[model samples]
Target: MQKLSQTQFDFIIIGAGSAGATLAARLTENNQFSVCLIEAGGKDTSPFIHIPFGLAFLSRMTNLGWEYDTEPQSQLNDRSLFWPRGKVLGGSSSLNAMCYIRGVPEDYDRWNDMGAKGWDWQTVLPYFKKSEKQQHGESEMHGADGYLSVSDLRHTNPLSSTFVDAAEQIGLSKVTDFNGPDREGLGFYQVTQENGQRCSTAKGYLTPALTRSNLTLLTKALVEKIQIIDGVATGVKLQLDGQSIELTANKEVLLSAGAINSPQILMLSGVGPKEHLAENGIKVKVDLPGVGQNLQDHLDIIVQHHCKNRDSYSISLALIPRYIKNTFNYLFNRQGIFTSNVAEAGGFDKTQYAADIPDIQYHFLPAILLDHGRTTAFGYGFGVHVCGLYPKSRGEIRLRSNKPNTPAVIDPHYLEHLDDQKVMIDGVRRARKILAAASFDKYESWEVGPGPDAQTDEEILAFIRKNSETIYHPIGTCKMGDISDVMTVVDSQLKVKDIKGLRVVDASVMPSLVGGNTNAPTIMIAERCADLIKQEHK
Candidate 1:
């Protein structure tokens, strides 16, 4: 470990999350340049993080997770939704459901259309392939040998297969591989796992690179602000163990602090809207209006059902014996229910109003997820998560107070747009239809949520308003765009506008949210970003 006393490096990357982990590992590969990776959270030594099924318990771990709550949303009956982001080494990748989904090609092409040049699907697919070590071997679309392990689930509940079968029975085609050419269909989801264990970026990238002398990793170091001189980022001010310290970046200061903190850091460092900065008692340095704007997330609502069959995995007194057996099974052989990623199966489909691509995504869980898996329901049941992939609503991340310890105010402005409400309603109605298919006739008992009483559009909308929660994919707060884009915080190369030696290389730099999960796309972004940085600095 490099001591804090050594306060300078060729590169300083903040937030040891998905992007930072990848960038740090990739940038230091040559050993010609020294890199520093700092994380606000402690080391990812939690045993639960490495277990696939441990997601059930990881959400309640306040220390390992950034358990942030959104500002009360007016559209959702004035409810504050909880969003759990990973505060560990791999960031959300360590805490996420482990679903390895990349959005459709058109999703990235849309970014090209939105002024993010060189980021079209054709151009970005290489980066996606570059970081993947697919279990099924290499294809034109997948890499066989790479850092991250992408594979089929080691064990999947029969209920998960039933969900796919139910979708097929409802006239939906069954897709064997979602990351292949076609993305719209029902199928089992591949996960970021290796031999039934989670393969977080920390496992794929950081752990291997730790042996290299050029890389320095500092954990539990909270970066309070960026030090900008003459509109150029030179270093950062971070607090560690109640002591403040400063570290200089000889070449560049890369902000890979995910979506929320990346924007918060930018704003705190005087690189946000001038007016908001003044109100927060921050000195304006760049006056960029797009620092925390263009916030987007997938708000999902689940349709739960009561299962008549107890064979399926669910919470019940009868399952205790099975649970004990499964625990032993996992400890002995690393197989069984312990290998399940909860949301073992899912699919994507376009709604009637979708524009050229699928607009709704599904995550079929063998067990019900209540309160983001915080509350345990006492019964054997299942849930189908329905989310509008292309949400029309936009929100922002703003400073509640100038203090770095204060959590930023996140207002997703969910369902604020009328189209978002309709899409979510349609998605739920579609999910209901799939669950009602004849494939589940034997298991069907009764609808546990929104029931038959919530049939009409109004009733369904009301149900959604009351029960919707974030699917944990948030992006586009420090959006990348063309030079002409007035709201762009970073250019196409991810360079902060009007600032030298600074870049934002994370989900926040995405011009728009992808069609599915954000983790895979974030890794791809960092893969390409590492190349960009090396090419520029070499």
Candidate 2:
């Protein structure tokens, strides 16, 4: 391969998703280094990109999402699952439900125990604070001024508030903040919004960073592979505009390309398991088999129920006029139904016994979501999303072939661990208990999904195994630990242990899946990684 361009950048960050954009922005602040960020997706300019409630619609919108699905799972009735990842500048943070969750403190403490230095609760807290700006004002646990927007929803639907009040009726406490010092009980969620609009990572970090001359962002460019010379990452091979091009990295090459693509890129570039590469007819750059192991994600089994009144959100021709009004208000006044993030409020709670934090989390929807896409028939219903916070399940990602655009073998291997199955079972049972309680009976007319028929532990397990789907919080592919830890792909500083000048700084590096939404924690990881890079240069 010829050296197409002689220019070299101090840093080249692949996949301008959540972590890539963030790191590129912070690292270029010094103006002493040039940064190049490459993203395969187009710009984040869609109207739904800023609307909170529009996420339900965006998941089906193929233009903005990377509609990746997992291989059939043995545990889930052999069902193939859907995985919607944002392919744009902000990544999933641009298309997600906008829920702001920092996970639990114990999540980071476990990282410290696994030899990931400076990743404990105390060390990571500042990074979280630095990445976000809490609307409720700063406290010891929260920050006020930061790149990411964190604010309470403006037009909170009445039913969501009623749901919270009903929880108190059922003797469940209404904890203010799940990301606070203590994590427990049900509460209204603090969303990643700014004045009734979605404030994505691109809007927060990359957009502003574009003003600086040191930062160069290239969209609609796919990173096909990393270029390694003498076991050192030197550049990248990418495809854009119907042609392939090569670019060099002067200092370091960072792979913040999420879990699925990051590991796939490493393997495609000959840096994965030696045997797998040999079988696939690719020369092995390194024999790091752990490049695509330890995949984990939350599985949510929705329980829908018919409502007694007209509070449900069912957009029909009859309601199209109302939706039009709501959309106008969002564009002009920045309020109304468009501002309401339907997956508004929920929390974590222990299933078996008393504990400081909750082992399970809930996503309370104000409208009926029968399936992935809106069908010709519609009804009035609300859903309770039950998920296991700390799942013991583990999966792996392997290269399907050497092709860069080829989808990898993503095996969530959900419920492979018996304990994970138990937790999910308990989660379903607990959701039923909540719906059956007096709080739910006050407004709920009928049990729709996994209804009264799906009873008993066996029935619940069967229902969960058949109907459950991922919450899109996959992590732990390129993990970090001591060098001797054979399963870990990165060291404490996030560098690939066997390959020099190459590192992966994304959710893929998370050794364990964070107990809550992966968005906030993913941004925090970028802040922490930026510090590591800065200290090394100093």
Candidate 3:
């Protein structure tokens, strides 16, 4: 295979993940400019990857995942749970369940408040629209023709209608679109899928752009460090197949390497906390304290119940043929339960006494998820994953050493804030209320988790302490805000403040966590960042 020796690409995108793929696609849409995308993972060619229901299988497979384990979380009784990220073309987006959540409208409005200028709902909404092919069609809140397709859950389970009814019974308002003008209520989830298949950024953005003559896609090229010269990014040193190679950036280098790797790459290239680097024997090029700080993740605990009579959607010995039929249906027609995004349906909501925005997000899965991210679990049970959207807990990501191959120290100090634990406890209580509603009475036999007898808040809290896990949404490793935000790596335009010709465009740039799933917003950042890069050159 030939290697890139020229330092003349119009743009060089690091990490062909959600944001990087979109950036490469959008920027290279024209034939005039050359765009190069380098990914450490090989091609995304798994059949399970395209099937939404296959999320269960793929979540456990290591080929499509950069499976990471957190350092023991002392707050959670010292458990180092798994954290899987996509290493393939669309990155995590390809491996993820493909939930299409834009978070709260106020989230963007608050971004404007937090010194992220022009990122308010009105300003950012167009970018969201530009990247969407909504199932609900174009409206005041959605678009019809975009790079990504947003569709309703075609494989709806009986548990969905029951969950919605139970949520309403517990006083949560029912809604249709969680990403609409008003974002406070329970509703059917819209996913990033097309014809029942997962619509990853590789399919949505990169596929079309790859046809462009100026675009280049390189797989298995691991970026070791950004090559900085006099406080400006000039190129990068990449290690490919045990061989070191250097490639220059003619115009600019965009680090869409995601929250974890972007900051890791920056620190390895000598551009982070001075003392931290010196301690590791790496000379500091830039003393940016915020290079890998302000990490946030949505923590959730499942509440399970054993159904009585024919209530729970558990299959039977008689249902084996149906399951087999659905499997073949997905293999051939790309439709059926095999395409089920187990989080079949859910919504955003908050109690009356809760904060202004919807603080709690829900994930209602039809299957009993005994352990999270597991391809298979026992029993015909269901899970209600309630998470605090904007948590008070703040964590950080730091380098273990200067080695790019060395996984960074990812510590998401979960439940560090006493308030965060309290909020999560309250979130668990709310989920229990919905589960215990009259709508759920039909399914009630025995409480599968925490058991029906443990009703006190303390028991609920204890259950959360024992079983709560990350919902796999991590952000804020390179938060973007204002100059006063001395700890921040990127400014409002997402440019590395102290480094020229460099930008970080991934979940890491989120100043604060959004109210829902991060995939849609991450791609939106790429769509917007593409214009920002072009404007800089023009």
Task: Estimate the overall C-alpha local distance difference test score of candidate 3.
Answer: 0.83
- For lDDT, the strongest prediction is 1
* lDDT (C-alpha, whole model) for all candidates: 0.91, 0.85, 0.83
Flag regions of model 1 displaced more than 4 Å: none
Error of 1 at 509 (Å): 0.9
Worst 10 residues of 3 by lDDT: 306-315
The estimated TM-scores of all candidates read: 0.98, 0.96, 0.96
Put down candidate 1 lDDT per residue, 1-538, tens digits, no spaces. 3366578999999999999999999999978999999999998888889988888889888999778999999999999999898898999999999999999898899999999999999999999999999999989999977799999998988888888988668888899999998877899999999888899999999999999999889998899999999988999999988889999999999999989999999999999999999999999999899999999999999999987688566678878998899899988898999998999999998777788889999999887777877887667788899999989899999998888889999999999999999899899989999889888888856897989899899999999999999999999999999978789999999999999999999999988889999999999999999999999988
Task: Give the range of the ten consecutive residues with the poorest summed lDDT in model 2.
Answer: 370-379
lDDT of 2 by residue, 1-538 (tens): 2222334798999988889989988999879988988898999998888887777688768888778889999999999899888898799889888899988888899999988877999999999999988887888998888889898888876667766776666668787887877757778899999988888889888888999988878888889999999989999999878788888998899999999999999988998889998988888889998989989998888887886566768755567787889888988999999888888878777787325567888998878775454333366667789888778888999988888888889999988888877887787777666666666665756887787898887888898888888888999999988789888899989999778899999999999877889999999999999999988876
lDDT of 1: 0.91
Count steric clashes of candidate 2.
1
Better of 1 and 2 by lDDT: 1
Question: Model 3: number of clashes?
Answer: 1
